[model samples]
Target: MKTLVMFGSKSDANIYEPLKSRLLNEGHEVDFRMISVHRSPELLERELAKVDAQVVIAGAGLAAHLPGVIAAKLLIPVIGIPCAAAVGGLDAYFAISQMPFGIPVLATAPDAYGSAVDLLSRWGRLDLQYTFDSFNIVMERHKRGLPHFQMLLTRAQAIVDRTKIEMKISDRPVENALNICLVDINEQDPEAPMPYGPAARGSDEIRIFVPALSEQAYREAYAGVAVIRRVATVPGGIWTGINNVGNAMLAALQLANAQGAHAAFLTNAKKGYIHA
Candidate 1:
């Protein structure tokens, strides 16, 4: 498999080098480059036009536009790793995760190269693989009816009401149905368990995380899931500037719907006052 790894600045070597090495070790044809979407737009466009890779992994920070720009130019899957350049990397995370409805840039936690690799593996582009035995155990406990699970369902219900998306909560993945699971990471416990069983069970299931103030929740969730498969982190910080619940929910809906369904969905969402 061929993989292209790009970053905004050469100083980001510390972030992208290990991922490149890991791809090489996994017997992938790795093409590493330093192309800034802002500083070198023309060059970036030129490179992307001729690029021949199964997937692209881009890392950037502080209004990270590299991944989104690449995704716009390429039809292949583009995974974004938001670097810790500003505001605990929340700015970059939102910039990547909150892309427009049609163009999707799979956003992961800061420096989350493992998640990128795992996504590639799941796509059958790599030989490496992972098992979800522990994740399944955690989900089993949630199935037995945990307090937190109830809380998550309540929150999900609220989100459903607001977004008006036809979705349901299920222990197993349901075909033609939007399967979603909500996990709250707003607690102070750093060692808290993040049960991402729905994500592990199906690639189509969307996992939404309400991150804590310290942003440790994002790290923990990314570490547990370790893949880009339909995962999202809602807008969160000390001030909570914007409510991105609608965006995340719409994104999930778009992913669930057919390919050309984005335009209609985006139009209806706008009419319904939902930010898409």
Candidate 2:
């Protein structure tokens, strides 16, 4: 898996490099860059398109807005790591938390702790399910679910009609992920960035991070593993995902940003206080 690590200029390399090294050991290719959201807004904006990262962990100290603008692009997930040197991590937290709705980013503590591996592991699960779903459906019709399809599908159809929104149709991602016994079914996205709305069965992993969601809303959407599926685009949209478990943690950070959590809280670092 590939991850892009973006850090603020003011942040100490002592803290930043260690985090990058951790990801490297975990068998991931990380793009470590020292461009701050506040210092180099122009260059910062450009990298969003350039870096095709599965996950982005953006770190900063003091009043850092690096993760905010990056998440605003509404592309991949942006994780903010608040440095301890900045107001005990408060400055980083507030800056990230104040993001307008619909923008999602993730965060981690300055020391980052054991989160690097924890985050990427989730992405790996998504990739696993994606692979299985594709094979079960396309290769063998009966391989995905309980024996004999016609009767099972009919019953599933009835369930959808009774509750509204497709439930467990054979073609539905929900069924593929569920019947296939996927662990993190919700992590998958309904529609991948592709030519169509959803992809072929099990084309890619979908990681969803939804906050303040109703039971009904969550159930109907994310019913499949297709790379392209239209499941009602909510304001927060789906939190971007990676192909494995570790990156999922990265997605979690960005999703927290969407829910208005501060980036500082993500880290155990400190920030400076305002002066007269």
lDDT of 2 by residue, 222-261 (tens): 4321211222222212322211112223233333343334
Tens digits of lDDT, candidate 1, 34-150: 988998999998999998776788999987999889866655557788887775666676777666644556667666676766555444521212211111111233443645454
Candidate 1: the clashing residue pairs are none
Q: Per-model C-alpha lDDT, please?
A: 0.54, 0.44
* lDDT, residue 116, model 2: 37
**Local error of candidate 1 at residue 106 (angstroms):** 1.0
| Model 1 bad stretches (over 4 Å) | 125-169, 172-276
TM-scores for all candidates?
Answer: 0.57, 0.48
RMSD of each: 9.1, 16.4
Error of 2 at 94 (Å): 2.8
lDDT of 1 at 173: 41
Stretches of model 2 off by over 4 angstroms after superposition? 128-276
Collision count of model 2: 56
Quality of model 1 by C-alpha lDDT: 0.54
